[model samples]
Target: MKQKSENQKAFPRFLGILVVASLIGGVLGGLSGVAGYFWEDHTAFGAAFAHLLGAASPWAMAACAAVLLGLGLYQYRKSDTAFHGWDGEDEDVMQRAEERLSWALLLDSLTVIVSFFFFNAGTAKLPQSSDGNTITLLVIFLVVIALATLLQQKTVDLTKKMNPEKRGSVYDMKFQERWWESCDEAERRQIGQASYKAYVTVSRFCPYCWGVLLLGNMVFHYGILPSAVVLVIWAVLSVSYTREAIRLGRRGQKTE
Candidate 1:
């Protein structure tokens, strides 16, 4: 009886979702039709986006860097403080700080890369551009790189301070490898779990990116390179995960 009741209740939610999907599909189809009609000779809309991002890339990066430094340092200090007393929430504080700082590093790196991209793109027309303007962009790009490196090193050093068990210098070429080797079993397990979660997220998000890229191509003719890059990333992730899983399975069976 409960199963039947649950099935009956599920139909309304299912139908609602179906209706919502249909509405979205209908809207997209209608807009795509209009876009296709206008897309014939006018690619201004598409090319304009890159130009705009390129123009604003430095400012975007500056904002990200500011947050990366300010909030990151605050969190690090909060976690590093010794006054957490009885409950021993220090571990939690450190973990939270580490996670936020890691994200800040990632965000800052992305901004630096984006700024570099725009700088490179803008340089293609350097002959047409004033030397002063070109020099400014170049200087900003260099500063962005230097700032990103500083924030990354600070995050790593503060992380090490909070967790003395952590090892490896941020400047070391084999830092990641050394850090992984230094992790104890529990830390290694946590790292593995986080990696697996990231893998799963990227795997799921790839399809949405594919769909967006397809739409962009249809409307703006950005070509297939973006989609191909996403495919390559997905393929690498899947292959590496599978290879590691198989290797671990084999190792488990060998009574070494």
Candidate 2:
């Protein structure tokens, strides 16, 4: 009973973190877009693109913020209901709700990171040519998207292994139900905790890194440090956080 109570408390705290992160991300992203528009060289096609994004940044971020806030509210309401009405009968529903919440966090975090990148690049004064740099940027964008997709697929595969019934196949449901029936409560809780930790760790990583970068950029503008130095720091932090994410993913895999 005490353990269950602790878990309940942990979830709300997590949701609170999610809400705060989302709000911060939206604001920062919008600010970045505006700054980029003003700072970038206007002659290049990239600059024109950035300027257009700057014009739209605030509205785009506002929409994202609304969605994130809505998700947070929905999670809070669901948590309240689960707290008061939870019974063994609704375990599956509770599990699904948690999974959905995790996915929401992941999506929100990615949105923020992408917005930050737009702002970062938009603010930079790239070469005025519509040549190699543009091609390189496009290739990098595609690679990033591909990597994100692969990671998402890996996460989904891990989830399927953890809960076969989660795939919505009737055969898998029956098989997994029987399999899970044989597992002890401790084992089940271990898997759940691992999965939850993995999701939360990944979701928090990007915002934290971007937040640092944003702060560093602010400091740099005051001439307290070189932009190159700030970029180095951002690079180091990003690599470290990425490594941590990989470690968390591996830990989740161990549960399977």
Candidate 3:
């Protein structure tokens, strides 16, 4: 209570600092805008863009795709190695490796989606956004998708061989339910911790994102739909969290 009161006492000082900072920022911004209004050679940005976005984008996409594929292959090999070499003794190590492989598999699925996107975007910078380019990109997309899917399946199968209690089919509609139900108490706790962290992170970010979206709508006339969507999501999350907390409290789930 003393610490809280002390901090509260400093609030006016902090508010004064904030006010000063805002004033200085506004003055600097006004001067910069005035300077920009008279400045020529704005086309210098365009001149630099060809080498940056136009030329570098394709290579960047290729590098990203290669790294994703390489990492997936590396993860597969690591899992395969652990699965093959493990005696019954290294259970903890096996568990750690299994966790890493599981996360890698999840990320590799994202990689396939990105491979599709980056390949498409990279190819779009070509001399022509032609039918042939589209066809090639689609082929690349399918190939990566297949490769990522098969690799994940093989990794999961290897993990299952080592531990038969795991359950989930990729194609199953209720896979999350089955997999979650199959989790041991420790795994469930881990999931709970992960979920709480995600919730907290997003909660912290919502205000900043909301402020930025509002600024975007106000300054750029980007429309209220974008900001409204964010608010709707934030509202849903807030209500669900509050409702769950209240329900749990009522059910006597609170710790003593």
Candidate 4:
């Protein structure tokens, strides 16, 4: 019962954090846009800021990529020993690691996309004499992309190891069947219910905010095209998961 309660609490906590982050991002983005719009007429601050950004962006991106790479390497190296004696506590630890890695993958992917935009914006602001700066920025972009790819693969591998039974691939039928055979009806129902809740929550909430952000960017000419692409991806994933969640929910209900 306590575990179930904690599981229920986790959803609300996740939602709250997401909401707070979204609100903060929205406010900061709005303020930056406003400041940028007025920058030309009011002060030299805009140009200076752009110059600083162009100078700093490469280092910033490289640092972020390095941190992600370090984390991924650490996780990959430690995961085996961490799960050596799999018990309920180990299961919980694995679940937490899975969740953290999933979020890391999502956020890091988005960061890479944002870095592209930042690179473009910075290069546009650069003077023609600074050809070297442009090359440096390009190199940083490539390095960040490489790091992001490595981190993503590492996270996926870790997630698969932690939850091999949950992997969704037609070729994995044998493994899936074996996993299902290992679980009793009650365990299956619990899994189904949990999956249904997670998918439904994301499908219900994520698309609405994404749509708002997409429309806002388009109308304001924010040049966040990657966001639009991400929105579409999110919509597709939400729909796919919603269908699966419904199927799982129905199965759980029938079993009940």
Candidate 5:
């Protein structure tokens, strides 16, 4: 039997893939949830499309809460990676980045929920003939999403800056002769390890998180179901993400 290495011990092949699958699933489920909201709001007998599109306060609050809850669960489960494996000079930098990213995600999620609740509660307190309140709140929501995106983007960029040698896909590094040549042995090893660790930590699905937020906005805007099957599809996707993480861990060990 083949001996499993440290990487394998920390991130089993099956579990890694499960995380990846969860990333994909999270993205798809978010999209599906958004679509479902739209369908319910705009179908023939559905809730008024304009009300949703305008992001009536209560609904917005609910949507925000859903996102927070889903992503919060994901992060809570995977946040241990900052200390799970790896050690050496660059380890501190890696851990700091991981923690920073986690907090950022948490902040974004919480802010969204709070904002939604505030907007809805205010709307309910004061009676109004026009939907000025709702529209104003939607605009605010858009701005918040944009700002959140920038913050996350900056956080990811910081990680890249701190670890300059480990950007882009493995294929990109391998195919580019000039870039590969520029790397010294130490740099190469650092890059390789960092890249592999990242593959192992599907700890948070940032892309999917954002995608779901966008989907929510779309649902409110379009008010069309688009598709209901996305949920079922993503249920399977979660498993696939987990599998991919695990497979990458296994592959890294083989290379060692």
Candidate 6:
């Protein structure tokens, strides 16, 4: 009989394909937006873009762009370090979590692209701080970062899954084992503490990373959309991803 584990199971495989498609679609759509954004001065399209970002000044876009990018980098570092705590048995769960995250990242990329096209027309003809090329380039940079991080996470997931014993951390196994054995008051407290810390670490950094992502989309959408909107979206996505990680973490708790 064929091994079920070795088989390319439908859901994960399907999700993987969808993720790739979404990323491709978003990149293409974003390019169109860049073209339209720089299409011409005093055109109807330019006027509309100004209306979308909610700021007529291009300098506003520039400022937010810098902030978003800076925050994105910081969040990336934090996320990178957060997962180092998980060990061998937790590897499969983490891999699945990361695979799901990859799909979400791709969807976000596509959303950013679609938002750009939605605001293709009707922004200010003249940018406040920099030229259209500069702003468009910044948007591209955001896309690059999103793509890179997702790829890195996915690769790490695959590597861990492939060599769980060799690369695995002993601490993760001991933590899980101990947590499972004693469900007593002190143990409960330790479990709660570990769960909370893990959740917060993942939840905080993941959303910031995703927030920076949405900010890119917002930039495409509003030209200078409110920072409030960006934060709001960040909160929503963070909650969603957090719920997912918690569910996985709990499952891991049970299995061990």
Which 10-residue window of candidate 4 scores lowest in summed lDDT? 164-173
What tens-digit string does per-residue lDDT give for candidate 5 at 146-219? 65555545544444554576444323535345445657798678867875566444334444544555466455
Separately for all candidates shown, the number of backbone clashes (residues 3 or more apart, or on different chains) is: 0, 0, 0, 0, 20, 17
Error of 6 at 88 (Å): 1.3
Residue runs of model 5 more than 4 Å from their true location after superposition: 1-94, 109-130, 168-234, 238-256
Candidate with the larger lDDT of 1 and 6? 1
Instruction: Give TM per candidate.
Output: 0.74, 0.32, 0.66, 0.48, 0.33, 0.25
lDDT of 1 by residue, 1-256 (tens): 9999999999999999889967876787677767877986676865786567656655665666566556655654554453233155546655665676666666666756666676776565546654555676777778877777777787787677666888899789999998998889998999899999999999989977987786677666669999999999999999999999999999999966
Candidate 3 vs candidate 5: the lDDT winner is 3
Question: In candidate 2, what are the lDDT values of residues 118-217, reduced to their tens digit?
Answer: 4445335445434344454444444444544444444444445545544422235374565466566886888668866765665556556556666545
* TM-score for candidate 3, residues paired by index: 0.66
Name the lDDT of candidate 4.
0.68
Better of 4 and 6 by lDDT: 4
Measured with C-alpha atoms, the lDDT of residue 81 in candidate 2 is: 58
Candidate 3: which stretches are off by over 4 Å? 1-62, 109-113, 116-131, 210-233, 243-256
Task: Please report the TM-score between candidate 2 and the true structure.
Answer: 0.32
Name the top lDDT candidate: 1
Point out the higher-scoring one by TM-score: 3 or 6. 3
- Give a tens-digit lDDT track for model 6, residues 36-69: 4655433676556555454433344344434543
Which residue ranges in model 4 land beyond 4 Å of their true spot? 1-40, 72-80, 84-90, 126-130, 165-256
Candidate 4 scores a C-alpha RMSD against the true structure in Å of 9.6
Alpha-carbon shift of residue 59 in model 2 (angstroms): 2.4
How do all the candidates rank in terms of TM-score, highest first? 1, 3, 4, 5, 2, 6
Model 6: residues >4 Å from true position, as ranges?
1-83, 107-256
User: Model 1 off-target regions past 4 Å?
Assistant: 1-30, 45-49, 81-132
